[model samples]
Target: MTAALPRADVAPVAPAKRRRHALGWLAVVPLLVFTAIAFGLPALAVLDGAFTAKDPATGATSYTTGNLTTSLQGPYLTALLGSVKLSAVSAALGALLGLPLAQAVVGSRSRALREAVLTASGVLANFGGVPLAFAFVATLGNAGVLTVRLGLKDSGWDLYSFWGLVLVYLYFLIPLMVLTITPALEGLRSQWREAALNNGATGAQYWRHVALHVLAPSLLGGLVLLFGSAFAAYATAAAMVGSAVPLVTLQIADALSGNVLVGQENVALALSLDMVLVAGLVMAVYLPLQRRSARWLDA
Candidate 1:
């Protein structure tokens, strides 16, 4: 070599680089181990159990698709359709309501009001299941505040109906959409609006041309999130309607219990079928959304 490298510099550099890599890998170790033990094992177990049938006599296991077919019959099919309709409506309503709320909050001049609105939205976003159900009961249920104050003894306000469920779902979905969409709203350059105004663009024209384009991704993404949330919901339905509503989640829960007439094998198969359907729905919606988002990014 023309000149020898300094030992102190080279030695320290190599060790330091190695140490950094080791630390980086170390940070991921806990997550990797936790995923393998907790999530991976449980999922595999469910899959294996779903496909195998246990003999009620000798406890022998064998493969069968009888339970899977039974799950596809009328009752489960009806529940699936109902769940889809309810969730779709909820997500749509959430986006419609949320977009304006987010706009208002983002457009505010006062910092205190903005912070207060954001804080309230965040609280409501996490406020679903039992607490939300109770809140609704207090507001709109029998002997509720509205009921008593309006003297609507026979107001025909039944919270056990399908529309009632949609209303409850929206209570949670709106806040979530606001939380998700607000970031994208914030990321939008203010100059775009100012530029449009400078060019003699009216309010409607500016919103149509500039604001809508920027917000489309966040809006659709928010709808997808709301759909998944309402689709997979169990607690709200259980607390509110119980078995009377006949939602998929409630049906799945019923099948899993010991009281079901179809037995555990059938229950397992039904659960697997339900899971596959839900997973398929999510992928069907999510793949197109991802592609759209990517297109927007490219543009």
Candidate 2:
């Protein structure tokens, strides 16, 4: 017998799938356009300015690495280091506090409690920028009501310093972490706990030996989110402390606004590039961990 001919349905399957995939991408065309316009264009502009140097007298433009070199030298490097330090510490503390709080909320039987906590977290997480700065300044800054009444300033509490910024950052960062890890906390299957208990494991043992292993990726991902959130923070830091703290965001602002040094705008752009690279690194680590967590959680 001659070799059987392929069925009509089978022959058309690949093209039909390709068409569906094309339609899927087409559906997201608007979003892709928006992203290009909003993010991609600005990024390109920053990248160009970061490497382009302008001559003052001749009004000439040329590509150079001087801006990048300047950004990595002197106080700029200090500010970058300070920003990384602040983001790391804030993210760590936020994760520590948020994970437990999320766990408590998730483990509770009261749906109302869980709803209330999540609602509050969602609000507080977004409650940053200038308004947040003002709130903290009023509550903890020098001559603040609480500061005076509670004698916190006399106790050496300064809300315009590095540690103080860390505290302010934590206000929102903790809530953000809670929101991020809540789903991961919920993704934790009850069966795992049951199985652990059935195997004569204690609560702490179950977590240390079983639950923590599974939650590790999600936890790290949430920490990355918090780090990025804090790293890119500007308004709150700028308003609260100005240049009192050596933060890269403040350095960028000062450079752009000519508040620190005039005609260092290119350096500001280079700093922006640096921040972008750091953020890219954070995302690279986060995306893979998130994918792994999702796979395990879904399975």
Best of the candidates, lDDT: 2
Highest TM-score among the candidates is held by which one?
Answer: 2
TM-score of each: 0.85, 0.95
lDDT tens digits, residue span 3-72, model 2: 9888877888899999999999999999999999999999999999999999999999999999999999
Q: Tens digits of per-residue lDDT for model 1 on 267-297?
A: 5556656766686777687768756765654
- lDDT value, candidate 2, whole model: 0.95
Candidate lDDT values, in order: 0.79, 0.95
Clash pairs for candidate 2? none
Clashing pairs in model 1, backbone N/Cα/C closer than 3 A: none
Give residue 159's error in model 2 in angstroms: 1.1
Candidate 2 — which residues are off by over 4 angstroms?
1-15
Clashes of each: 0, 0
Q: How many backbone clashes does candidate 2 have?
A: 0
